[model samples]
Target chain A: MNRRKFLKQSSIISLGLLACPSLSSAFSLGANNDVIIGHNSHKYKVDLTWGNLNPLHTPVNDCHEMIQDSKGRIVLLTNHTKNNVIIYDKSGKLLETWGTDYPGAHGLTLVKENGEDFLLITDYERHQIIKTTIDGKVVFTIEYPAETGKYTTKDDFKPTETAVTENGDIYVTDGYGKQYILHYNHKGELLNFFGGSGTEDGQFLNAHGICYDNRNPQNPSLLVSARELNVLKRFDLQGNFIESFNVPGALICRPVIHKKDIYFAVLRSKSAINSDSGFILIMNENNEVVSCPGATSPSYQNNKLNELYQTVRLFQHPHDVCIDDDENMYVAQWNSGKTYPIKLTRV
Target chain B: MRKFIGIIIAMLVFSSCEKQQKEVTSFLQQGEIKLTNPRITVSNTLIDSFVTLKPEIHMEKLSVGYEENGKTPTEASTKLHTTISATKPGIYKFRAFHPDWKPSEVTSIKLYKKGHIPNKITWKTSANKKYKGQGETTLINNQKASLEFRDIEWVGFDTIAKATVSFNRKTYIKSLTISYLTDPKSWVFPPASVTLYLNDKDTINVTIPALTEKEIVKLDDIKIPIEKEISTIALKVNNVQKLPDWHAGKGLKAWLFMDEWIFN
Candidate 1:
């Protein structure tokens, strides 16, 4: 549990020892109402008040995604032009805010190079991927790959996410437009492109997210999220289709890896417009779903996973999740009435 | 009594040593906890033999109560712990119940028995190009679409959609039921009115009320009782020409979606 909850429970127990019989029952009830969510070994206590700020100054619209910098501070990205990036300490205190130019800031990724932190922000409206320092200074920008010959114009390339390998090779997923994975070098030169919109094993429908999986360290690959198809496809670094698996009933937004586990923020259950149908899914190193935070417990039969869906209305359109050093999760939402990120403290 | 007082003093001393965190209030509590509606699933609502409805709720300390005769389900209704076997066609309503939390809103579905199969069907006006599903055969195909308006079974019209059901011979029919999808969030609403022409002679007109606000996505069945036995029926369904000012699509025309037409 987080430090704040630990102190509160400690005080409550200390007071309960000397309180009257009637008051002790109320104390126990208050402790039980901590509102824990998730299942099995991945349960968490809900912290709804995390990262809340005054809307007049730090207003946010469509909290798209979040990540943790090397300084151990939580960074949030939103589409609202007023304050595109908001930094906060682990205890939910606002540290700083910047960037009024990113009107369509959708994806945020942090990469460390030479002991310095850099952020890769993907703006779908601008159709560009920008690299910036931790404090909001633009280092360089990568425009739409016109030389790839696959895209006719800049409007046909709407990049949603970018994954950087250890050697500085960048992989971008054009999720909203042509649904192709564009591979580029560190100098923003397009190398190869593949995976157009199709139902075949090599193609993708809505390749919403991409992540470089280095769990094995020797045989690293790229994991892409096919949101509409409810499948996760694995491809070798050279962009060859290795295999794919289904998470049946989930519209996963992205795959965030930490240690031996993979986490995802399911945008919705079945239909895109099905309001308040979002949840969080967790998978172990073996590529098996072990727990669903706001949904049903994971169960498999005959090597086929059961169709997973939301069981509680704790979240609405959870777009992304960021795991901190303490293993706590910060959830950013999309299209869910302008609200702040919610913190889930692992128990 | 003296020892109890001493113990209370020591407890206070130890509690004061611990640091107190800031008092932060979450805005989530503004919306009180309300149980989500239970999901009711069946293979097909258009049944020839019998249909089994499986009502599911995964939360603990919650029970699902349902009614089969179209009445609103309440806490005192029959607790549905297992699947419901229905041998006849009727409306089924369900709601989730908990002792501490607010009860969920009611969700209902309709089941229709096998009806007269039309030998031929034709539409006077075509549906919107984006949502035309297999032409006129979709109405008599007996396949019902889910709440999603994009389903292949739904044929949506932006204007008045008229269809004629004809049989090889004069077939006796008692009533006609029209199954349509309602998802107000997507600007899909029920038809404003329906006009039924029996054998191109007698006319039956029914006016549908507009929705006051957004509602859940569900397929609703509206039954038109016709006691007069008829062979050929001409059905006309009208779309909402202009949405209400309260709606986001205030001046735009709302879509009218139909999946099936059951003739009993």
Candidate 2:
């Protein structure tokens, strides 16, 4: 036993304290898993060692994103060139692994076109985005659009994410590079671009992630994260600024929408927005945050979110999150000691 | 009237249960916190005065986190170990904070440093044995971060940062490297000038340029190195007097983190 446990046991034995197992266990009743996180409609049971694999051969530099495929297999993307992608089953068992060409594989987006599912993988180091099949076959690749005249060189096109439309058109956010979102048609032709690096409304600082918000089916909009500025700006499909809202105390990454709710991998809290501070945020259909997984419980006073902070240091730079068919969450972190994704099962 | 009172009590109990659930939503369910008696371990006796605290986390950047003042509920506070020196030297029961989801356990630490060898203050703390004293000696470690004792309150003329080093005999010191963590959260703005008094005789004033970044930066601009053999070394700095108006700690003194003096 550790020193603290020994001290407690010794004190109890000396004082003739009787064990109260039944009473102590009654308060911590959490279905199957004793530990519980989140609040309201988003509470979950944490499983830290869910997707841990041996690091001798299959090592990871940064666990970036995870997604559930059409076959219900959980797919994870990492920067480790040894195996950039690892496919797993729902039961946390390693199914298979593939891809070696992606050294800085960061973003993973699943797109279904013509009744066949494909993957869009963004490479930060190579400054390119590749469209591939589930079997790791590259179909087409996109580089920096020289026609846009915004980028001086190919190095300025470090795209981080891509959101595909129903017609195969894609919107790529140059998050780490020029902070612009480039729009492309089905044939990889540049159509328009929006956002630059600034504090202006139309501009963004570290536009890390982007996704299409189809919650309002009649009017679909694009939700992009200005991570450093702690705001999520909404833009029309043609790349026009619509509105922007604040996510207080969240240095957020890409916005992930699962079922009726929206989720975000908060890279850092507003109070301690440093290198190794991060958490997870969950919002209801009304865009009101109902739960913060690794931080303080979400609270709102007069429609404004209270400044959120990390009460539990569970995550270090959480880059992305993937919600499965069973409402479980698989979180991927960046620069968190080369650890794998953690699973949070909904209780 | 009795039935109404009974219903009100039942409603209050349910509301309290819901409140408790919401409070523990952000708490860790899997991890267990065990805090031991705090120790200040110096890795290298000759030049290293680093102190490793309990419940350590990799502290790249620092913000004034929750302090376990013992009375505050554990679920509401964070455990932090900071080193503070009293005005005079004596044995002290420094409070240790160990906070968890449940009640916190405050441990009182008792340790001694090599104090007052003779006419000069001779501090003989080594790597093997740990000392629990503060002042005139900066603490640093490789695993986590510095204790960051300077990041509290809004006070000007905070004059406790005078580091003194005493040697066994006269030793040659041609050059030295001063290591410090230049983090932004704690507003650790590097000092503009460093004054060093060596051997109770000669004094050297080195001017440092303004710091521009948030990451840790070293000062190697001390042009004329220490050319004489000296038995004692005392150092001080002229720091920023006030914080910027745009900062949260506006009009207050900014904090500076300094550590590790390497003799070359």
Candidate 3:
């Protein structure tokens, strides 16, 4: 059918559902249940009640990254149509949106230091790392360096995620097009680059995510998430391999650090959808699974309602995750048929 | 009686002086000509078609004289024309309505002494292709490809001479068209094969199975053709498969080529 006919049919269907409460509730997970969190901290059993954050009216597509700003406001980065980076607040209110300029924004990070918050973003289309202010003002921009001999052709360069150190050193993962971890000094200078596209012990198939670990204040390590390989490889501040572990999920997007716990948002294959429901796996300092919220098996009936209530919880494709200082979890999801960023507060 | 006579003499002198001042003002007003035309036709040749016309009135008092390449004109028509003449190949402005009424739209008469001719057409190849310059054949992987022509004079319906290019081997020609140029509607291509690529180890071998007599055509006019001295034609090879190589080396060196080259 033509676009007009499709739109007309969709509108009619939507209007019909609006008239019927039960039909609308069954079809839409947002309209029926409010943003719910696991309320009881002691038992760790989530009630799934509507939280303060409202549901966004428009459906989100490929939400790759999210971050909470200095003002306790949640900023989501999505691969919206035509390179638009939409920003939404924690209350599910459409705050302000900008950035049609960077069409392939796949990763976003908010770095706060010295009473200032900066937005560090990566564009797969432009194959570059960009630094902007909290309000979307560009502060620094760096393109893929030609010195990295990994690229046989210019088009083979795509930077996925960015992590900034306390001292302002920036690390970008060339995940989509190229497989390399690029590091730059605080002044936007190319300090060094290591790691190429591979499936070896230290190499990467898709170096999808990166983060600066300040857990050891004296010596900080860089955590790189290799999605396709289903492993999180820990590296030294200078890009040296330290250790690697198998992530519980098939497609691991991003890993967040909260206090002494590390949380990763994982997407399950269709076979593992219901039984092994997609959820955030939290690991303690000993690298042991402490909390597994949502579902642990591939049973559809057990996780269906849980998946329906919080689509991000049964995440068909969870792209990125971050933890605020308050220990609240923010997740960016893709292929969930919704556009709003998901927020999960720790019980 | 004597006082009355002195008063009359003083009045006569004052009248004479006022008459002389009025004559001078009239001369200034008559010397200036107000151009009413506003629009000047832009020809392809001239970069600046500004009119140089001087107003008969004072420069500060002139409201219709040429101001910044014929944007503002003065009330004096003669001065406006004179200033317009100073600029070679100028445009003249005429008022569409009276001064008391706001002019609807200014009209201009373009003075084009000679017609302009476009530069000679040139060609360029993809940077990945080894060949460069016109009529040079480059090997491109079999896919949807393009050959660009630049610097050609844009004549609405005029046709340029076509050159015949033939490939020795059977190759699938997906698309033949021009990019970054005007008249997308006039793009044309030759017919070839679709599934040209077969199973190969190093490179996906895409051989043109057969060639048809049908010609491909595309016409788009919204794009402004490039004016560079050189343009490029691209032969694209697509649908390449990566073969399993036991070597530990990185990246595969693939080959795809165009057997013949031509321009018409």
Candidate 4:
């Protein structure tokens, strides 16, 4: 079956997945060296043509995150209900789009299960963590944890993002709720929960994002966003606290690891929280910020990163970054006037 | 003839200027206060519960109760929620004085429920669906999650990020509690100000101070004094578009984040 035809037949377009128009600023490579974004070996070229579809049909709002599945399809998750999940091939052609169950659909994570692909989504509106098939079938649903004695009401269970370990253990970050990280088994039973809202070394304020850190490969842990403190905390997989590294002046939404480097969407640059004062951060395994795309270059004095800020007008409240197999980056923005995802091909 | 014409024009201009000045003065008098020693008056008294005062100012000291000849004024206690009340009602006098300002005349009121003063009101953000999230329900849901700006619970707008909530029908509301986040590292500052509309009619304008990590601000009778039944409520937050003059990313659009619009 052709991918575009599959999308047209799936009720994805007619289902009201409205996307705001594209926010591409007209520029040519010959004019300004394209501003040459990225750091060290992770630099990229801006490719505006990448996953653009006519907004009248497949529209996207707040392209939150993207992931490449085993079939080599680029799957993008958006809050836009027209098509909650937009699947595109490497060439930027719409292969298919599915799902309408997630109105506050956020945090797209793809994992291969015994040669099969599954998608995990955290819905802020529903306050539930939904595990679904790539085709959008609800496989498992994890409601808010009550037995933990942490949450007093349903309103206190806002789940923002999720991460699954190699052995199929899932960690859900209640970044918007009580600011705790819940560890669960493959069947979706809570195994452990840790982290809370505070300014302490391990406590998190606006623990907005989370991910499984496999930098050690042998001893994997979790990297959580203490966004308000402008830092990322590392914790052992069992929910034990480890250490925290500061990205001074960068309210990073998430830490995206590609190969040996980690990238972040600096949600804001100055001390402010949700402004268009954002840029991209690329750092090495040592947690040292190497480059700041669309902002001032990263600098370190005595191992402390200087307070960084946006120097370019490229992005407004960029939320997340997804690195493709070819090291290409897809930048998703929140509150950016409904613009489509921006593609950055590795230079 | 030329001299007479010039005099006539001058007279017209002066008369017009006088009318404009009067209008401007009236507006300032209604909206603002001229600082005196203690220009305080008791607007309303809810018996032994709370007393609403008018002409509240940045004060060095304020004490209110009542006084008699050759007697000291009985000072009422204050609460953090902005309340001051007396156990008994009598000849109530309010004495407020600023160290740097001129002395003010004492404000005295006779207590009477029938016609002595106005009244008071209060509101709270309850867990209910009587108020529905109007546009971009994702950022602010029925469950009241995602009120802040993150990848999870925020909607994008061009300049101002606003969230409208419609009541079940026409409803009365008095108080509101709003939460906001400002991350300077990402260049997200607090909103320039927050404006609220009731029934699309009256407005409550609030300016955000320099915020830290996260803050939940509660507004009621003192800070915001509108106790009316409004059908529709609109909360408009201004995104900080530029950095401060001394910062590096000055004059840039800084994203504003808001959450948890609790109305009582």
TM-score of 1: 0.85
Per-residue lDDT of candidate 3, residues B100-128 (tens digit): 22332343433322212212222222322
Regions of candidate 1 where Cα sits further than 4 Å from its true position: A1-26, A271-273, B1-32, B43-50, B57-61, B69-72, B87-90, B98-102, B122-138, B141-143, B148-162, B167-174, B184-195, B203-215, B225-227, B238-256
Which runs in model 4 stand beyond 4 Å of their true positions?
A: A1-33, A272-274, B1-264
Per-residue lDDT over A182-271 for candidate 3, one digit per residue giving the tens place of the 0 to 100 score: 888887788888888788877898888888888889878988888777688999988899998665344566667767767777654222
TM-score head-to-head 1 vs 3, winner = 1
Q: Kindly list the per-residue Cα lDDT of model 4 for residues A1-347, writing each as its tens digit.
A: 58865555444332222221111111111323333455555666666556779998999888888888888888899998889999999778999999877888878888778989999999888888999998999899999898799998777888888888888999988888899888899999999998888988778888888888897888898989888789999999877888999888888887877787888888876432225678899988888888777665677798788778654346688889888888778888887877877787776
lDDT of 3 at B207: 36
Per-residue lDDT tens digits for candidate 4, residues B1-264, read: 644554555455455445544333321121122112233334433233445545443322433333423233433422112434444545555444322222333444433222111121222222123222343443323222222334343333325755566665555555664534444554546667778887778888987664444322111111244577766767676767666765457777765544334454
On residues B24-60, what C-alpha lDDT tens digit does candidate 2 reach at each position?
A: 4433353342222223332222222322234322222
Is candidate 1 or 2 superior in lDDT? 1
Model 2 error, position A150 (Å): 1.2
Ranking according to DockQ, highest score first = 1, 2, 4, 3
Native-referenced Cα lDDT, model 4: 0.65
Q: DockQ, in order, for the candidates?
A: 0.27, 0.05, 0.01, 0.01
Candidate number achieving the greatest DockQ relative to the actual structure: 1
Q: State the DockQ, from 0 to 1, for candidate 3.
A: 0.01
Candidate models: Cα lDDT each = 0.84, 0.67, 0.49, 0.65
lDDT (Cα, tens digit) per residue for candidate 2, span A269-337 = 754524465889988878788988866678778888877756555677899999999999999999898
